[model samples]
Every structure is written in structure tokens, then in C-alpha cells.
Target: MPGPVPAPPAAGPREVLALAVPALGALVVEPLFLLTDTAIVGALGTESLAGLGVASAVLSTLVGLFVVLAYGTTASVARRLGAGELRRALAVGVDGCWLALGTGLVVAVVGALATPTVVAAFGVADGVAAEARTYLAVSMAGVPAMLLVLAATGVLRGLQDTRTPLVVAAVGFTWNAVLSLVLVHGPGPLPALGIAGSAWGTVVAQSTMALWLVVLVVRGARRHDAPLRPHGAGVLAAARGGVPLLLRTVTLRGALLATVAVAATTGAPSLAAHQVVFTCWTFGAFALDALAIAAQALTGRSLGAGDAEGTRATTRLMVRWGVGGGAVLGGLVAAASPVLPWLFSDSADVRAGITAGLLVVGATAPLAGYVFVLDGVLIGAGDGAYLARAGVLALLAYAPLLAVVPLAGLRGTVGLVLLWVAFAGGYMAARAVTLGLRARSDGWLVLGAG
Candidate 1:
């Protein structure tokens, strides 16, 4: 009953921006939730903020490790759509949602149970550990919602619809900001819950976002006559497909966790400053990832339509855009380095540490841009196995850089600066080399409706 597949369109700046802009909006707004939490929690003093940093590192690792849900689903659905299988594309999306639900449930239970032990692994101060425990425990409730949002966002993106996610993200961010402010500070009749309040607020916002997105996906499925009931086989298949991406994610998270661990050794001021700088770095990276997101959808669609040449041309164009975007972001980050630390802390030591890290972040933004775009393009092409392998190589390349900070007895602002150097500079460059090599080859130019 399906119509013939239409020819894929030319890859151009207009096409790229059409998707990238909205994706950028959604990506930017997503991190503002964390920024809001950081600012609110920072007000409770350095210990609370430091605890937040530790807890966030753990939670981020857990959540980020599962990002295959979104990336895998996007490529799968986009391929189906390109092959002229609308109903099948929607069906794949549904399976991804189910897979995300099951995984989130298991992770939340295991994570909640293991919270104290995991927090202890960081070996932070008692005050920081206590806050970390409280925040991580409450935050587990939202893991399912966060994952559901990821799968749902992937679904819309595969459908070439980024605007809806942007709107949803905006609404969720506003809700989180207001709720976190009131609950953390205890305005009106509300009792102040401190860091726990930030956790609760984020949970509520993430839940709302999940429900809204699921409803939209469900409606779309119904219109396309896609199955609403869970298919065990399909769910299992989706899980299997995600394995390589999961591996890739583990390598990525491993790098981040290693960096965070080293930062913890640099003392509370350095650790807190690392947290703020890392947050900003993540914010900037995700902003650059807008191009990558567009790359994923476009590359998947092109390959699905058997447009290898178009895929190659589009990739070249996007890479240039990525470098340009990175340069602009680096400039903004550098410009704000002077005043940015003031928003997060009042301590002179923490501010000094933060300034040092931001400089490294500014200097290395272009490499991040180049790496992120290629990473997305490959994901869209469903080249997860190669990505997984390259990720390990990149991690191996970064091990030496990360090891030197603590081994060499670097401390204070100097230690923090080198830590960012290991990550934003050394680690990013390694990624660029690996990804760039892959992009130059024609092997990833797989052509098919798959």
C-alpha cells in the first residue's frame, strides 16, 4: 500500500538550517535546566554546589550512557521513512519508546539502590557526600522520563520535525526554572528543601516532558496505523541494535568520569569550579551538536534513499558549518569568561579556578565542532560499530593526558586548567583525528532503504 520512494533532495544550507536551528533551540534549552539548578544550588554555599557537581557527574554518566536510545532510534526511523515506509518508521519509533521504558526502569532501581556506594567512590567530603546522596536518590525518579523524552525526540527528528521538540523543551525549561526557584528558596507557603528541592523540580519537569512527548508520538502512530501494543521481538531487536552505541557511550562517559575524578583531587574550590566550567563546556558542546543532530537526520535520510553522493556533499558542507559555529561559540565563551564565574560562586578561589578552565574551553571549541559533526554523520549512517571502536581509541589517546594532572601533583587553578586541557583540548583533538579519518573513507557510505 505504500507509495514509491521519492528521490532525496539536495543537501544545502537552507536544508541544514531548517533542521539545525530548531534542534539547536531544543538542545540549548535542555541544558538550561542544569544551569538553573547549578545557580540555585550554588546559593546554598560551596559544599552544596560541590555535592551537586559530584551527583551530576554520576547521573550524567548513567543517563549519557543510554543516549543510544535517541541516536539509534533516529537512524532507524529515518531509514524507514526514506525507504517510503511511513508506518514502519512510526513502528520503529514505538519500539524504541518501549525499549527506553524497560531500560530506564531497571537503571532507576539499580541506580537508586547503589547511590550511597557510588557516591562514596568519589571520596568527597562528608557534607558534599550527604548532599550528593540526597540529590541522586530523588533524581532517580526522573530517569524513565528523561529516557522517554530522548526516544520521543528521536522519533520527531526522524520525521524531519524539530520544531515540536523545541517548543516542548522551552515549556519544560520554564517550568523547571520557576519550580526550582520556589522550592529551593521556599517562597510563599512552601518549605525550603535546599538541594533536594532542585532534584524534585527537575523530576517534575522531566515527567511532564515525557508525558507530552509520548502523547504526540502515540497520536502520530495511530494516524499511521502503527501498532500501539509492545512487540517483544521488536523491543529486543531495538535493544540489540543499541549495543554498539551503548559501548560508544561508555567510552565517552569513561572519559568524563575520569576527568571528574581527577578534579575531585584538586580540592573543593577546584572541584566546584570544574563543575561550573564543565557545565558551560557541555552547554557549548551541545550547541555545536546542533549541526550534528541535523547531520544525523539528513545523513540517515540520504543513505536510506540511496543518495551516497548527496550524503558525501552534505557532510562536507556541514563540517565547514560546524567549524564556523565552534569558532563563534568559543569567542562568546571567552568573552564571558571574565563575568561567568560570578554567576555560580562568590569565593575568590573557585572564581579563579573557573576562569582558568574557561580559557581552555574557548581555545578548543573548533576541534569539538569538527568532531561532533562527523560523529553525528556516522551515527546517521548507522556506522555504530566503527564509532564504538574509534571511541575506545580516542579514550586510550586521552588516558595519558588525564593521568598527568594528578600524577604530576598539579593543584589549585593550575590543576583545574590542565584538567580542561586534557578534556577540551587533548581529548577533542584525538576525536577529531579518528572521526576525520572515518569521514574521508567511503566505507560509511552505505546505500539502502535500511
Candidate 2:
């Protein structure tokens, strides 16, 4: 007893690009902060760098899992906006921010108390473990700020504003670089803080960005007539909405962390090389993620506008963009393979491993593109429950390949290359299969009456 589906709206390349380009800029800026930290921290010596590697893995995993804040908010707010519920959309974001603060506080307290145990879990050397503990402890202080930024960024993205986050991220990264350089080396009256300086710098930048975002959100709420204070029902709803995404994020983060663990078994040089390659992969991922962001925003808006056909059209365009963008990024990675590793470390072994790893990453970039875009499209359609199930299945398919790496006696450059192939290629392929199948189905196209 449903009416005929309305014809899909016309959306072309310009619309996709409008959302994607600025998003790409903002997404790219985020990882550059860590890349800067990596480069600066590398100067202290390999052990310090390795320690950073361990600590950052933990930090990244934590942040990645909580990325539900952004993903969930973007979907919900965009949908509401598309439905012409501006105040409600803004209110959703406000609730999301409150949820972020509460979750961040819990994470900070637990992370601080458990830093030693968590670092020790990596099975690194004593020196590395000690340094990791130092970094993790300091970094934990910034967890609340980091989570708030994630939620705020999601709010902005949902509102179809990426340029602001880009500007904020750029400014924050600059400040972090300056603070870290001065503190790490003691250029003035400040004593040298070494590795701890990097953590402090990150905290400072995170706090600044959080405060800036709070101001932006507050101002916008006033303009939109959205309530700034938390509503218990809205907060609970936000948390509930993010549950599926939280699961999906957990599986994804678990896969990455597992890959890191596998790399660890290959030795410190391999682990260090893994870090460099992983950073490059992470950086490149943001480009594909840009397409995903566009897909999420556009798809949500289309559905909110009660244009299911338009949502379908948007998904197709995003997939095309994802594949093309990934190919270009992959080629760039290949071309830069020779020198990229050198920037992070002077070690011949590490560089050799990185060179091999980058090639695998480049070759698999297209698959990654497909996976990332489909994920965004699905998320935008409010298909998080399906994504959660799909993610777990893909992780299962990926685990066996990861487990076989250590037993295969692969080591050095060859081992590193194989590891990445298993992760970047094998794992991504698994994800593509699951996501592709779902995208082809109409089951996920549901749009409630608007």
C-alpha cells in the first residue's frame, strides 16, 4: 500500500565535489598532525619513535572506535536537515557533543589508570614500554578534548560545512608543531621534555580545537534556536544511535591493531617500517574517506528529502569518484615510495621494508576506495546495523591471513610487504565483497515518511 517511488533527483559531479573537496582537505589535515608528530618524534632516536608507534596505535584505536561520534552525528543531523528540521538537527548535534564529553571523560580516567598495563600489552622492549607509558599518560589528559573535536567535526560535516574544520585543523597542527619543537628541545627557559613534549603538544592542540569548536557550536545554536544544554532523552538517543557504528568501528580498529601486532612479531625494524607505511595508508585513506563523507552527507540528505532514487544515484557517483581518486593516490604513493620512508627514518632496514610495503598499498588502493565509499553510503542511509554485521564478518575473513604471516617465516622487507598485502589487499577485498553485495540490494534504501 505504498505509493510509487518518486523519480530520483538530478545530482552531478559538481554536487559531489562540493561536499568532497573540502572534506578531503579536512580529513587529510587530521592525519598530518600525527605525521608531524611522527617526524618530530623520530629525531629523538628509533626507540623513542618506536615507543611513539606503540602509544599512537593505542590512541588511534581509541579514537577510531569513538569515530562513531562523527559518523552517527553526520548521518542523523543531515537527515534531519534534509527533512527541514533545522532546530532538531542542531539539537541532535548538541546531544552528540554531550555524549562525546561523557564518553571522553570515562575514557580519559580509564586510559590514565591503565596506561602502564596497556603499553605493556604491546610486548615491546622495556625502554619502549617506558616511553610509551609516558606518552600514553600525557595523551590521556587530552582524551576529552579529542572526543569533543570528533563530535563537533561530525556536527559541522552534517551541516555541510567542511571548510571550517579544515581551517581549525590547520591552525591546531601548526600550534602543535611549534609547541612540540620548542618543548622537546628546550629552545627557551622551558626545560627539555623529549618524547613527553609531543604528548603535551598534542594535548594543547586538542584542547584549543575543542574550545574553538565549542564556541562555533554555541554561536550556531543561538542562530538556529537550538538548545545548547543536554537533554537526557536526546543524549540517550544519540548514544543508542551510535551503537551499531561503535561495533563497526571496533571491528575495523581491531583489524588494524591486529595488523600492528603481527608487524610487531616481525621485529622492531619491521614494526617501525609498518608505522611509516601505515601512516601513508592512513593519509591516503582520508582521500577515499572524503568521497565517503560526501556519500554520507548526500545520501542522508537525499533520503531525508524523501528521494530514494537520488540516494541511489548519489551512491553510484561516489563509488566512481572513490575508485578514481584512489587510483591517483595509489600512483602517487608508488612514485613517492623511494623517498617517503627516508623522511621518517634513516635506517636501511626500515626504509627497505617501507619501500616494499608502499607498493602493496599502492596496488590495493582501488579496493580500499571501493570499501571506504560503500561504507559511507551505507552509513548515510542509516544502515549501521548491517555495517556492524558486515564488519565483523570481514574481520573474521581477514584474521586467518594475519595469523598465517608469522608462521610463514616471512621477515624483513618480504615479511613487511606480505603483511601489508594481507591487510591492505586481503582485508580490504573482504570488506569490498560484503559492502558491494549490500549496495546492490534494495533492502537498505528505506526512508521513513517525511
Q: Which candidate is the best by TM-score?
A: 2
TM-score of 2: 0.87
Model 2: CA > 4 A from native: 1-10, 38-51, 123-131, 185-187, 190-197, 263-276, 334-356, 403-419, 448-450
Segments of candidate 1 deviating more than 4 angstroms: 1-7, 38-54, 122-134, 178-198, 263-277, 334-359, 404-422
TM-scores for the candidates: 0.86, 0.87
Model 1 scores a C-alpha lDDT of: 0.89
lDDT of 2: 0.86
On residues 20-139, what C-alpha lDDT tens digit does candidate 1 reach at each position? 999999988866887899999999999999999998878777668877899998888887777677788889999999999988998899999999999999899999999999999999
Residue-level error in angstroms, candidate 1, position 177: 3.8
lDDT by residue (1-450, candidate 2, tens digit) is 001132124458987887788888877777778888999889999888999999998898888789899998888877776776667778888999999999999999999999999988889999999889999999999999999999998888777777788889889999999988877778768898999999999999999999998788777777878899999999998898799999998898889889988998888899999998997898788888888988887777677777778778788888888888889889999999998888999999999999999999898898899899999989988898999999999999999999887999777887888899899988999999999999999988877412
Q: List the residue pairs that clash in candidate 2.
A: none
